[model samples]
Target: MGPGAGEVSWRHWICDARDGRLICPIDIPSFSWDMGIGDFGFSTTDKGAGKIDESGLTLPWAAIPASTPDERSAMLDSQRRAIVTTWAASDDPEDKGTPLFWGKITGRDDTWLDTSFGLESPMAILSSRYAVRDGAFKDGHSSDSIAFTGMSYRGICSELGRIATDGKQGGELPFDWTYTGERGSHDRTDYQAWNVQNLAVDQLLTNIANCQGGPDIAFRPYWADEQHIRVRFLAGSDADVYLDMDHSPVCLSSFPDGGSLEDIHVSYQDGYHRWYATGAGTDQGTLTCYVESMAPITQSMDPPVLREAVYGDTDTDNLDLLRRHVGGVAQNNSGKLMQITGSIDFGDTDQFGVPLHPLGSMWPGESVTLSIAGFPTLPDGDYGLRLMEMSGDQGSKADLKFDVLEAPFQ
Candidate 1:
């Protein structure tokens, strides 16, 4: 029997616009699915702003046999309108069965009888909120006029909730979401203002992340189905899973075996040691602040180390506050950095060998502790690593790339 309507398998389905239900597409010979989270890092020159990379999915269906040209045309049309609410669930019964990805069809290409569908994670929805007004006007306005002025991370999410549910933007948000209320315990007395006149929601969130100090914070959003979305605020090194070589589900005997860490890169240039800040003011007399890394300068490095500056506009002129700002920047750039990219086959079962969520089923920003035998550089300890990007087809195999979180100098 054909798959029933609203049935979900390790396959793609188009949501019926009329009734908002998932319906399997016709003539699917073969299909592949891949999805993952994006890599986020600090930008050296952008005033410590966190740089968020994009995450998405690529699904391609093999030669679908269409008996008639009219049938082919209808299929293409249906796919187009249906891209807005594309959803997928793994065939693995033990898999969370959550919508692995909720995305809009980004592209569609047809050749004879086969069609390919491109999908991106819901992050696209967040990025869609961009600066709508000019920065100059926003800079001129005081904090009192901004909606989220001096709001905590929780408060910020509440404001975002307002935006998503108000219906002023037309269609209701496809998924329901809530703030997890996770934030650092830093003094929030330093009032920060955002010009809501034209700023997008994502831009404001990015600014908040970059400027806040203490534990690094992140926002992650995921969907289980068309009607539910969960947003979580994660603090530094908050790992979702801990994988050990002997106890973990990883298949030690498989091809590509466990995983490998490589591409070690390190640098300590003048750019990494200096910080500059331009305070709030008109062109004529704005104060410019400079700070240096606490790490003692090494005389051996050529081109004598120079200073880096972070510029911003705020009401505070207190030198202590300025020092605090620059200090945060210096600490952010102090550590030697490295990255590991490889695939680990989680043996098809849990530690007890019972079949469960396929090995390698993970998300971006999720942390994992590795206890592999090789690689002396990465000792068998509880060092936290965040998954930056992951990809794999449906089954027991998967690949992941991640960044090692090195502790900043205290």
Candidate 2:
């Protein structure tokens, strides 16, 4: 029989994180993945929580053994990993299925008939390792300082990833690592310099990527073969501009001519009106910038409430760059930012009848332009989809949460 419409098939595989060797396959009856770039749709806090996908799964007790050393190692407690692949019901299983997630097993719960495991994206795994110090204690001088002199953002992340994986940096990691995409120009002088001390690999990477005008970074997985699953580093400021997805510029309009979005809810936060930023140097020599909002929201405050913030960058000494950095930060957080949450029904189509594949079409850090009727506060323009919380089981619609892209006062 042909597969029914809206039917989706899922497959799970437990693999050795070190070498990507297939450890075992299990039938996961149900699972949900919540993946995104930042904390859930909040504009004020640090958005450096880079692509930390989280999920939980339950498996039959017989699927993975407890006594076998290899199987036990493959279990969540041993820091092994799992990959989830899915496809349309009609697609042949012999073909390579789309890899939805690849994460390390972090926690576990066991019962007589079933066991549940917690899975987190690669950033969570990297967080466990710290950025290696520049020189060992045995090497005469020991320093926690790591320097990036005029290096592109992509190069910085690549170096940090290498430091985390290569034993020479600290200890060799089992899994392979590689990065792709470019951020700044190849001109050495064009890139900025940065120095960090005693930071975790994940923290260092996020701090760099979340800076003013930084590119988006994601840990993406690709199916290699039965024995290997490949994960690649993707970083780019204009990543989506290269895609040719026909459904893009997808409109979620309530107007008669367009398709409608369901369960639309909007909330706003009181963002800071004044920003004070310090970079490099100490005492009176520090480079600093201070700016206050002149936006509509700030002006509307009856008594003109003053919300202030202080920011620090450890490596930049250029005063102009520091000003630009604080300027961008102030612009993003100066007004009341809107946080929108909604869902698109499975098998739904856009106004032009293009099938809406929420997960397939849009990703975190990509841009989406839409218009809603009731919320005239949000102008019809470009908005960034910074965080996506996708949760569903089997054949179900995925819930989506989009954090504010820009200040609404604009």
What C-alpha lDDT do the candidate models reach, one value each?
0.41, 0.56
Best by TM-score: 2
lDDT of 2 at 315: 53
RMSD of each: 9.7, 7.0
Model 2 global lDDT (CA atoms, 0 to 1): 0.56
Total clashes for model 2: 2
State the weakest 10-residue window (summed lDDT) of model 1: 38-47
Question: Tens digits of per-residue lDDT for model 2 on 84-168?
Answer: 4444333466644566567666567677776666665678777776556434333444443445554566666776677667645
Model 2 spans with C-alpha error above 4 angstroms: 1-6, 38-60, 65-77, 85-91, 109-114, 133-141, 167-197, 238-260, 277-289, 294-304, 312-327, 349-355, 374-389, 405-410
Tell me the tens digit of each residue's lDDT in model 1 across 1-410. Answer: 01122223343345432233444443332233344332121101111343221222222334333456675455445333332222233335343343343444445566543355544334444565432322323455545333334434544543553453333344334434343333423333432335343345554444444452422344343443543444343433222212222233322211123432322222223336666676545676766677666354553343334445565635435565555655656675644445556654333345664443332245554555544444444444444565656554333344666654552321
lDDT of 1 at 256: 22
